[model samples]
Target: MVGRGGVLRRTGGAVVLGTSLLGRLRRRDPGDAILRRAARLTLVASVVFFGCRYGAGSSTLATYGLFGTIAAGSFAQLPGPARRRARILVQSLPVVWALIAVGSLLAWSTWAAAGGMLVVGFVVAFAGVGNPRLVGLASAFQLFYILASFPPYQPGTLPERLGGVTLAVALLAAAEVFLWPDPVPVSYRQRLAEAADGIAAFLDATAGRLTDPHAAAVDRDTRRERAHDAVTAIELNRSPPASAPTAAGAQDRALRICAAALREVLAEADRLAADAPAEPIPDLAAARLLSSCADTTRAAGRSLSPGAPAVAAADLDGAVGRAEAAYPVGAGNARDAPDVPRLCRDATALALADQVRVFAVGCRVATGARLVGDDASSGLFEYARHSPWTLYWWQFRSHLAPRSAHLHSSLRLAVALAIARVAAGVLQLTHGFWVLLATLTVLRTSAADTRTALRPAVLGTIVGAVVSGGVMLLVDELIVYAIVLPVTMLLAFGVGRLLGPVWQQALFTVLLTVVFAQLGPEGWRLAEARLVDVLLGTVIGVLAGVAMWPRGAGHDLRYNAARYLAANADAVDQTVQAVLGAVPPPEGALDRVRRRMVLIDSSYCQYHSERHDPHRQQLNWDAVLSAGHHVLPGAESLLRRNPPGCLAGWPEAAALLRDSAGRLRSAYDTLAEEATHGGTAARPPVSTRCVDQLDRIRPLLGEADLESVRHLVEVDRWLAGLADSLTRISPPAADELVGHRRKP
Candidate 1:
């Protein structure tokens, strides 16, 4: 019912309202404010230009164009490094994009153009976006959209249309830098600091819970969550460019080191359960000391300059001493005691080592020393760049399991896309195209950015589409069409300026759909038909994603725990062999140990993601991993001290080591419960088995070289101390068992 003037007024009013609202919302942060104002201004400017070009059929396009420009411009506000990189990317992207657009234009067929756009989207999403998998998902939907609504070819027309789109994108990208400018570029350092804070807090809380056996599980779970966050933060910088390569590399190393330390802690906790005393130690001074160390580490993160000194040595010594007190001489070796405390201690030590390393790294950064490569030569450096196979297995092994949705896996995304496409075809629902849009909206939503992108995309699409429909309804003349062309340019500019890249795509889609719907042979009454197609695409996308879980990140916690146990078993075998006079550890043995460790780390990491798991698998896995540290070293020490008849009771030592391995394996089996409710109540008969093994080995060590034997005993004592430290960490569910479940 609206006339040309009425529609123009509505658009003008929208511009004014959007601008005003953007200004109010800009107050959240200076960066946000600048971006919003730029977006608003760009939208308004586009409207003015469109109004001058043609009576206003291009108003919607103008708005969307501004949105894209503003969104792109906002990348400039990221932090210096991020902004600089984005600039390079934006500048470089246009050249490639232009080439592709030209190719599509030359092809001139609707399917070709559509397919090209979809392909471009896929490439950009994969290579350009933060995560490559997301690119595949977005590309899949785009493909559907293009297939469903390929423009009918006209002679020599594809090039012109493609040229327009390319030009618009180029202009929008430029506007992102010049008009809507991001105040700060994203900073890897900031992310690292945040991650450190999470880890520090976790360690502090866990340390506080040492004395309270009842609070052990709670502390373990909480720490796991924090550690997971820290690792993710580190992963955020995985794809750093050359600008801050040293920093980026260091950050990566620091994160890995932290993860490794945490793993050691988990292993220690497991050992601690076997060595625990009957009555819980009420005085938690040791726990408090650890908490202090955590606080110091966090406090140090606030000033993230490199080359920072480690936490004061005196404080470190004091904390270590306090933690050591938790493992009384008899506590771990007690006949019926669980080894929880010693495991807790070991996990704490690993955490402390990480904290110290982080402190050192901060000092180095602060002092302008380029962080070095993670090699053996870099003494005490825990910041290795590459993760071990252990971490990798821990990360991907779970994908082997069947699940409805793999939240972070690419396979799930591909399957989802395929399903959505098939479903759309079967439904024969043109109006359901919005379903694809909805799927995109859902796909992008996460704990970090929430739904900020999806909301704008959906809104921009509707606005652009409705405006195109209204334009067709009002003016069907060739003159009107000619006038609308320049107006379209301005609208594209506005959308480019405002909504950003993701929303810009949506805006582009809406504009294209509207233009075709209006100029086609079909009348305005069929507008619903176009909308239906859009909806169908969106629906297909959602259904595809929901049907086959890609990452399978939603499994029960017990599976993750079991994986952790398996990793520990492998680590134990390797560590023992290495310590038992196996120099350089037989080809693949050392590599296997490291690989298993990484797997454990990754498994624990999954627990912290936004996926579905009722029992907090990450926490349980951390505990299990922490527990491994204690048992592994103990098994290794037994071999080292009793190496091939060097000691009076060398055979006894070997037998004892075997017994320990068996006990650990048994405990691993018991803790194999992936689900919260599946844990077995059976305990390991640790003392009886250990005594029998010791009795058998005693004759082999019958005082042949008493002096040499004494030296070996000293080694054993030191090793036991280390093992005892590990044992203070976790209460083994059974006295004799260790929960190692990996198959040899």
Candidate 2:
């Protein structure tokens, strides 16, 4: 009775769970899924009809279907209608010719085929330098080499095969254009809304952590990751295709501002958590302020949805004002001797209030209001525009150097292809092209990426072979194979998005088996052959990756990290100069600084994604980036503020700031050198002159001037902290130094 009851309970739970999942799916925007299904059906039907009418055999059908699949997949990744069309047209030219040339070479000589593949690998890698489309182009060429190898090499059939591939490309391109005309806009808006929500969630999490030092690290990490992902999504949507109408520019700017503001707020919250006073403030006013700010920011985020009412500027101002008023002013100075705990608490409260004010201002800007108080330029839209061809050429020239990532990756791929060819020849594998295909697909710019690709390729291939083999054994008819085709393709592409490469590859393998089964009677044998070939190729690819350019993503990470720090230091110097009225801030200086921050953030994320490091280098990098984020808005605020006229009287203060800027720049340069070249640069001595100058100028300044001085001091203090963090991580061990003396 007990066992029966347990089984009944389990059955009921399963039914409920299944119903819930179906309900969620039913609620989703079905347009994307419907379009995708239509495309797949169209592709399968076209391939089958053409094959039957022409009696072209299963190989020809498979080739055509594969081309269509590639086109659809690439089209789906593109951001705008215009961009998708342009990519299709441009990518098709090289792909068509490359496939023909590869076929011709294989027909001529095995050695010629190998040489041709090597050249294709190098050219694709080189052309792809900075552009993602070019990289995909290269990948397509490599993939064709593998797929085209299966058919018996015949010179007479080359043109026919090429024509079939062309037809497939055209069909898929048409489907993409007519069936889903404006998918990118809907996707972009959805992503933007999600990003806003992510930022709000992060702010809420940060507020919780301010009072609870023991807050779950997992919660903090999850929120931080979500916020970062949201920022990435927004950045990607920034440069839409020229043909696509821009979304409201102001709203986009507002989203960026909110993201930046949240980053600043989180940084301040981190500082408070790290340096909380031993005795808690009596009123817990700062905590309450944070909680209120979180709620307000979340509400503002929800307002970002399409047609949602804009938040009122007055409401934003009131919330900020309340937070500012709650801060206990002069509490630290009230005692004859400073009470350490009270002073710490008061300082934290004031800083927290300042961050809240910045958040409020950002919220106001997000409501589409013009900047009334401070110069409210976002600097987000101020980017250098370049033509696609010009940008491509520039990237090509830039990465021509030996140390460039593009150059290194191109060389690695070329060498890996050469090796795979030799191994395939020696083994005398019937489908040796599979080895080359696996090598091309699995090899990436870094060993880390290669390893990441390798596992899924092998696993997916095996799973695909096993599953398809089992299905083929049960269902013998051509009609059954036809029915299975669309379902497999949809499952592969749809589930792949959520599960990553594994499911996608497995489904791809299943598709291949189904195509091959129609061509021949030996269905089981073909499946077994595919599994072995895939395993062989994956193993060779992984080995080549380790042996070639073993440093992988780590080298790029250090180089980029160094470059980011150097750019940041330069921005600091520029900001100081502008503030001191020495020279007007260079046009787009802050924009350039923000771009550097983006690069650093991207590189750090890439580094973290590679292999899990026991040393927690990601945490250290995060600290540096957080400090840099604080500097960006601070510099922008400094740029917009009008320095008091009395500042002309204090030449010493101006001179002191310039000196500090130079020192900070020098410190960062040293750090950059250490990161790239593994040698320490000389650290500049910290000067007390800035403090002395501030002391002399403070009493002479009026209230307005006093506030300006306070802002300047805060910038200077943040700079010092940044310098210290860089210094701590810059120097290497004695053995690592070029001129170290060993102990006797």
Residue clash pairs of candidate 2: none
Please name the candidate that would achieve the greatest lDDT relative to the true structure.
2
Instruction: Please give, for residues 333-361, the per-residue lDDT of candidate 1 as tens digits.
Output: 43433333333344334334433443435
* Candidate 2 off by > 4 Å: 1-62, 67-76, 79-94, 135-138, 149-153, 177-387, 401-403, 466-507, 521-523, 570-744
| Model 1 spans with C-alpha error above 4 angstroms | 1-82, 91-149, 153-188, 191-527, 555-561, 577-590, 596-672, 675-744
Q: What TM-score does candidate 1 reach?
A: 0.51
For residues 1-744, could you state the per-residue lDDT of candidate 2 as single tens digits? 999999999999999998986565445535555336445444644464346434655465556455545543432334445447545644665566566657555745556666766776687666644454443355655656645544356766666566666656555555556654445545444554566567667656655565564667598778877776665544321323221112222333334445545545554444445444344343455556556655655665566554676454455346445644543343223333223232233334344444444544554554554455342433432221334466456546645655455466678888788677766766776667767767777876567667768778888888888988788778789777766766666655554433457776788778767766666677677778778877877887788789877665457657867877777787787777666666676456656666555445434433432343223222234445545555565565445433423234456666766677787887777667666754455555432233343454454344334334444444454454455445435333322212111000
- Please, what is the TM-score per model? 0.51, 0.58
lDDT (CA) per prediction: 0.42, 0.55
Per-residue lDDT of 741 in model 1? 11
lDDT of 2 at 685: 43
